[model samples]
Target: MDVSIIETSSLGDRSYLISAGAVGVVVDPQRDIDRVLALARDRGVRITHVLETHIHNDYVTGGLELARTVGAEYVVPAGDDVGYQRRAVGDGDLIDASPILLQVMHTPGHTHHHVSYVLRESNGGIRGVFTGGSMLFGTTGRTDLLGKEHTEELTHAQYHSVRRLAVELPADTKVYPTHGFGSFCAATPASGDSSTVGEQRTTNPALTQDEQSYVDELIAGLSEYPAYYAHMGVINTRGPAPVDLSLPAPVDPDELRRRIEDGEWVVDLRERTAFAAGHLGGTLGFELSDSFVTYLGWLYQWGAPLTLIGENEDQVADARRELVRIGIDDLAGAAVGEIHTLVAGTELRSYRVADFAALSEALREKDTTVLDVRQRNEYAESHIDGAINIPLHELADHLGTLPDGEIWVHCASGYRASIAASMIDRPGRTTVLINDDYDNANDTDITSAT
Candidate 1:
């Protein structure tokens, strides 16, 4: 069996293409279907089936559309109420794709309708398991995505679901999970991406702890996720629109200014250093990278018209791809060129990028309020003494509560702090960004509140 792992780095999500003989199956595909289709073409195999572990709550799935494009069967969980035609698969059902045999196993933990597909060899020997959002490298999927009420119940179910895989499958059976690779869906940060059933039995926290202890630990470790996640579940249930990879229409300076005046978001997708040096007034600085989707989706208003500001067309295209994954398709336009030309004499906003030593000096010299924009769990683990914890997601709402003085913003790295700095920095408000590595926090004379 030839198995290919297609990783979407921005979301840390993985999709698999398993081929046997002349036929193949795609599992947990992203909205962009061309990549998966290209894999099949490269392998000289026809796509026979497109499988979804569940209605994904992170990014839009390309399963239904990919199935239609290739004339393949779209398979989903039996209990999912996805409003579209699909081959509803149930537990203990067997599917044949020529040389690869898939057995469906119901693992209701991440979601009540979640399932794991186990691959068997020609002689019915267990080969590998696609454990989407159920069993990850060192941890399991976060149970709180559904809601606070369902957290404990799902965590309890997750314990048994992981055990079921361990007891039923061979120790050498490989495990491929959809979440855990830098995704917020993971209960804890994974050690790596791929692990075997035997390795998980010994190393996975979910399998090592008792049921209640596991539930408690999982719940306690949960932190704030992207607000855009709320729209994903509903979008998946109702069927997402087909993805359009066409570049957004380019807007000139006047047009961009008009949209901004009309209350549309003008997001600048540049590095934090470039953004901090100089940027258009009121423009949000979100660096185009892996965490781009997560933080942009979290802070951006849903359904609001948006205009992207980037260094060039390619940067704008990259930013667009990331946004489209989370269903933020209301891209009004894009502005690409030199920053000065885009702004055109408008007073550029700038913030001071400080190192740990500079931050300590600033704190001592003035009444500077150190604002840590990391997640709650991160803040709870360790933070600078007397630092105010307002996660980046909640910053917009808590702006009024900021202390009346110089605000020093920071995250583990400067990515999130740059975002916060742009949002909070205005004419009168002086915001200094601690843009250095937070690991160097221990090197400073500042006390850490552990």
Candidate 2:
């Protein structure tokens, strides 16, 4: 059997085309269906089945679309949580199609209907399994995805699901999880992909942690998942909308900046961890680790020219390609040199956040106001008190409430606070960003006598 991993960077999801002789089974078909179809057309192979490991929350799924295009059977997890699929396959059920045999395993930790597929080896032995978001490279999927309800129960369920597979599957069964390292699905993810059952047993931290520890640690590490998850979940539930393969040309930098100044939306796509360390102020930060394409489509005001704050030149092409994948072709050229364009105008000065002493002095006046732009949960867990909690996604909504004072912002990692600090619109309000790691964080920032 020939298995090809199709990297659909549209929303940082992976799909597979497993071909045994002439039959093909596409797993977790992401939004970019045309690419997969083109691959099949080029190879002259016919796709017989389209399988979805689960109802994805990150991006739209192309399972139904691929099935429609190829007239293949659309298979989803057993519970029929997704009502549109052509068929539902339960745990331990096997589908024998000529040389291809797929055994479905119901892995419900990621979602109630999430399933993993075990493909038959060339010698008819079960060797590889596609573990979707249920189990990533290093950590497991977030239980809060479905929200606060049943989070603990699902975490418990997830633990058992992983343990069962660890013990039941052969030590050599290769694991292909959907989102690999660098994905926001889990923090502290494995360094690389393609791990074996034996390797996971020996090295995976999740396998050893107690159930409570597993839930707490995993929950703590997850950064804010993109605000676009709801829309993507709906799209995945119904199946993906068609994505036009042809993209528009990249825009010029000058044009892009003008748009940003004219009240247009622009998102900086650098790593959140890096952006928090330091960045140009006033830019709405969209860390690349979050779904760039997904958020680029939703939060992106239609017809607004986009200014990309790329990590580096190598990421420029990827940034452009991702924008195009979501029908956003009007990219106002990326920031020319560094992140300075975010605060390019006259009178808006940049001050580096060094230590608590400097920050305390900055906030010593009656007119100093500190802003916190982390998720609601993160803010509650222990954030600098007296800081207004305007989560980044809701920044625009709560902008009216920000006092016209020296606005100093900070996040756990600093990336978001930089984005938050940059977006403060009040004039004469000196902007500052604390380091993402907060090396100089003063306990007084949270507990000081106000």
Candidate 3:
């Protein structure tokens, strides 16, 4: 049996395509089914089942649509109260897939109905297990997504679930998880690219620490995830609309400006430095990069009209795919061209981009208002001595509270800083984008710890 990993690095999740001879099974597919389809086609395998470990809180699942398209059984954990049809499965249920058998094991933690599938050859030899959010590489999935009331209960459950897997499964059995590659669904930052049950026994917190210690650390470590995560679980459980990846309608310069004036989300998808150099007034500089979708979705008002201004059609198309993966479909329109042309007769907005060394020099000369837009935990761990902490997610509401003068904005990386600086730059305020990695700032005299 061969297990293929389909990684969606943007969301820090993985989908599995397990194949044996001509039979194939897909586990936790993303919204874009074409990728999964192509993989199965290339492997020359017939998909017989599509399995979802839980109702995902990070991205829309393609399992239902993929199963419907291929005429395969759609398997969901029993008791999720889903809106669509699926073969609701429970612990110990064995699914026959010819060359391999999938043994379901109920592992509630990530969600109330989460389950893992143990892959076994038809002859009953174990291959590996798809543990979804239950058992990640070195940590477990976050338990607080449901609500504050359920956090403690779920944290305890998560501990027992990982312990159960460690005890029941073979030490050398390969472990595959859907979240924790960088997904906010993880309780903490997961370690390594790959791991086995045996490796986890020595490294995973659930195995090394006692239940109380693990629960305490996990609950305390839980941090804020994307605000868009609230919509993902609902979309997945109620059956997400089929993904439409086709480019949004072409918006002219006039329409783009009108939307921007109307306070709609007209995001510019260029490199941060280029965006800082010149961009349309009132347009958000959400440079097209790995971290773009996560922050954009977090700050975007759900169901609001969103427009994109990209350097070219390909950039807009790339941004659209990333948006759809997180259930941000139905774009208002997009304008693609040089920034100058897109601005029409209006003058483009610009900001200063500099490094930490420049910030250090400026700080030494006089008092400067520094804005650190990283998360609260990140700000607490270490930061510039006198910097203000308004995390990027909460910056919009706190803009008026910032001290007057030229505000210098920064994050761990320059991405969030660029977004914050663009938001801060207006007719009345002077903003500087500290476009450098935060670690480099440690070399200067301004570094401090709380």
Tell me the tens digit of each residue's lDDT in model 1 across 1-450. 888999998898899999888999999999988899899999999999999998888889888889999999899999988799998998999877778789999998899889999999998799999999999998998888888888888898899999999999999999989988988888888887578999999988778888888988888878778888899999989998988877899999988877766767899998988999988888899999888888899888888888999899999988888887888887888999888888755777788888888888877887678999998878877888889999898899998898766889999999999999998988887878889888898788775666
Per-residue lDDT of model 2, residues 1-450, tens digit only: 777888864455578888877788888876668778887876667999888888777656767778988899888887755546478889998877668888988888778778888888757787688888766666677766787687777777888788777887888988888765454555454556578877787666568888788877766666666655655566566545555443224445555556666766666676654554555445666666445565456556656766776656557656665654444555656653455544445333354454455666665655556787777876666656577777877786787777765677777666556556656734466666666454345545543323
Candidate 1 residue 76 C-alpha distance from true site, Å: 0.3
Residue range 49-104, candidate 3, lDDT tens digits: 99999999999899989999999999999998989999999999988888779999
Q: Give me the candidate number with maximum TM-score.
A: 3
Model 2 Cα RMSD, Å? 6.0
- As for lDDT, the candidate ahead, 1 or 3, is 3
- 9: Cα error in model 1, Å: 1.8
Per model, how many backbone clashes are there?
A: 0, 7, 0
Cα lDDT for residue 118, model 1? 98
After aligning candidate 3 to the native by TM-score, how far in Å is the CA of 135 from where it should be? 0.8
Candidate number achieving the greatest lDDT relative to the actual structure: 3
Off by over 4 Å in 3: none
CA lDDT of each prediction against the hidden true structure:
0.88, 0.68, 0.92
Measured with C-alpha atoms, the lDDT of residue 310 in candidate 2 is 69
